[model samples]
Target: MKKSVFLACLVCFVSVLQAQNFPILGKVVDSTSGQALSKASVFCQNTTFGTITNNEGLFYMNLPNGGYDLVISYTGYEKKLLRISNTQPQKDTLLFVLAPQDNSMAEVAVVASNEVADGWNKYGKFFSDNFIGTTPNAAHCTILNPEALRFFYTKKRNRLRVTAKEDITIINNALGYSIRYQLDSFSYDYNTKISQFTGYPLFEEMDTTEDVKKTWVSNRAKTYLGSRLHFMRSMYDSIITDEGFTVEKMNDDPKSTKGSNIENLYDSSFYFVDSSGVSVGWDGRYRIGYRKVLPDKKFLQEFRLPANASVQVTLLDIADGFVIEQNGYFYEQYDVINSGYWAWKKLAELLPYNYEYE
Candidate 1:
């Protein structure tokens, strides 16, 4: 028994000695400004253990000795990743230079319905060439209601797993006229069930001149509200869709009672090509417009836009199409904006390229 106990103790001591551990400490900062990246999320790919950088962009964690793929994410910046294979308790400084998301297809081959042309290899090349673009100005923005920008940024990988239903409302207030709106409804699987619904005043009780002046929040909210509104209104006015995703000029839903008298005032469509002959994707090129309602129903919330305001995805040369649907709702400004608009939300699904619809 004495020999057995000694053997067990010896084994335990050896095991402890063989175990490996290290302390990983680092500071994350903006490459350009050298400013600390606060609340940045740091994690290992395919693992649940994670930590967030402090306000000073500093993080310290004890990790097992092994190779790790580390991901760093923050609001208004492109995600950064690094492969670390060190086991020394050491301090390291990492600088992250974030680029904006580009929203253009640099090259695309268009084939008619009858021709089964050779599969093209333009998708990857186009995405690569077009990956370079300037980020949107951090100084400008349009307001979003129920703003969850920070929450989305601080989460894991910026890959959001929304619940059964989700709502996104964008409002445009240009030239002091509250016009242009887009509402999206989502299913549990996270497909956009509806893409765009325009012309409906997202709310009633327009902010009075007094309210606009008195009910002021942060400058971020003000800029977002103003910039988003301006961008949408400009797109609606300049759209010339002779060739692109067939944009509907008017709401066909008989159930829609929004701005019924405003002839051709509300339109929704997919914009295909810019003047430069570049094929744009629905993710960014498509412009959604909304209309103004009474003062009582505004749904504008405040949040920060990504400094790099663009996101571009390149697809395989498959004929992937998106489904678009729209619906109308009665004006209930407070509940709609505060709790999220139900009827006005939209969703979309990717259909096979060969699929056709009447």
Candidate 2:
């Protein structure tokens, strides 16, 4: 907790497809009891495609051809993450066994009086700023159940840890969706200025009129541009420059001295790129700078940052190669470290993985 621990969870999985369909079937059961777990949430992480298990613990989903980070969660049980691939034909049903949380390991006693209340009052804004984001769209996002969150602050380590006692409901007016998120782990290290969270989210679209639907369509497209999904697609296609992005390598050595000259560090002279001139897979850290200036009046009014800002992102090593679907839906191990302008854009600006530009 004292170290620079950043667990940023900003991506949602949902993809809109035209025709290709891959059906996925799975079941959830208790690991120790071997009993079927009904009402357990099953979802493809980062996408709006998900469902709850039936009484028989069975669930099914039809997804477009691609890879997926499949997640399953149930109350009082450990969350399960599975890599799924619909790119190839599958003949077997998938199964997941969730273990009950070990009470001893999961318990955290609050020593201070009204610590939960005080911690929320003190760090709720910080959690919201980092979790929901500070973008114009984030303004439309409202967490429906803040009480489900329990916060613990360790002053000695300057770290704040958050855990969800229940699924947190969030309504996103900007994207026209309501999400139920099962947060497994969350931590913010003030010393390192990094925040991270892991959860499984199930999204339900709001019912709306044709006019509102059209508006959402346009809005989703706007949010998708220059997003993490778009950036990964550009990298896969080797069109970074065409997409108005520049890449630079940074000295991320933990032993390196911290420098004070921010502007000098961002100078174009230090720009870097892979000599192969192609993205082989999801592995590397780079400073990504976007040149496109957001023209949204609302964004301009709410956020204050220079027109150009850079974000640091690391594509964690994956056993299998990263997958980018035909529609720019990305499936891989990665995290975005927002800085400058991008840091201000939060949940309000989020689009589901299945979102498509018409």
Per-candidate Cα RMSD to the true structure, in Å, reads 24.1, 12.0
Models 1 onward score TM values of 0.26, 0.74
lDDT of each model, Cα atoms only? 0.33, 0.67
Candidate 2: C-alpha lDDT? 0.67
Estimate the TM-score for candidate 2: 0.74
**Model 1, range 67-107, lDDT digits (tens) per residue?**
45566766556567665544323556655544443324311
Name the top lDDT candidate.
Answer: 2
Q: Could you say which candidate leads in TM-score?
A: 2
